[model samples]
Target: MTSAAENILERPETARRTRLQELWLLFKENRLAILGLVIFVLFFSTAVVGVILTSGEDPVFDPALIRLQEKLLPPLARPNLETLAQGEAPRLGVYLFGTDDL
Candidate 1:
């Protein structure tokens, strides 16, 4: 019977590698894997950039500020001045995903 550390001491053919080193070695070995990793990073970065670009002081990006709105109207197909006059106007004057009644 032997401890795990003793087993490692007995093995001479294998080398110890940190997780990142092991992952890098595997990644380097596969071209498709590298491409997939690149694609995933690009997509994640784009989403982060999109959120940063679209966010404003209005708290639309801030989940803490979000609250229930009064009206539950279907989103307007296009910018309608009449909608503005009829009810609460959105920041962009159009409800991209419907807006508050106020």
Candidate 2:
């Protein structure tokens, strides 16, 4: 029931698919493209985790929670009085990688 134009359009479909496959193989061989993909995956994972932790009323990671005294302490340092008084103590009890500047 199809016309001549439809027949012509259908004929090259396989050739087009083959060409796309060849193009993809060629693209994968490029080192720069591979590096870009790795960087993309690294940042993409962190972004997803950040979104999940920072969502809703009680965030898993609160960006505004700052204890000035705890800022420079090394990882696993005990919670001193200044940081304790802030009442926003890190739930883990020790900073995994320590706190950075607010």
Q: Looking at model 1, which ten-residue stretch has the lowest summed lDDT?
A: 61-70
What's the count of clashing pairs in each model shown?
Answer: 0, 0
Quality of model 1 by C-alpha lDDT: 0.63
Please identify model 1 stretches exceeding 4 Å from their true place.
Answer: 1-15, 58-102
Quantify how close model 1 is to the true structure by its C-alpha RMSD in Å: 9.7
Runs in model 2 lying further than 4 Å from the true structure: 1-15, 18-22, 81-87
TM accuracy, model 2 = 0.63
Number of the top lDDT candidate: 2
Give the alpha carbon lDDT tens digit for every residue of 1-102 in model 2: 578878898775554457888888998999999899899999999999889887878997687777776678887876776636655777777676677785
Q: How does candidate 1 fare on TM-score?
A: 0.41
Task: Compose the digit string of candidate 1's lDDT tens values, residues 1-102.
Answer: 478889888878767899999889988999999999999999999898768755877533333332344246567634445534443344555556654544
Error of 2 at 16 (Å): 3.3
lDDT of 1 at 70: 24
Best-performing candidate as measured by TM-score: 2
Q: Model 1 clash pairs?
A: none
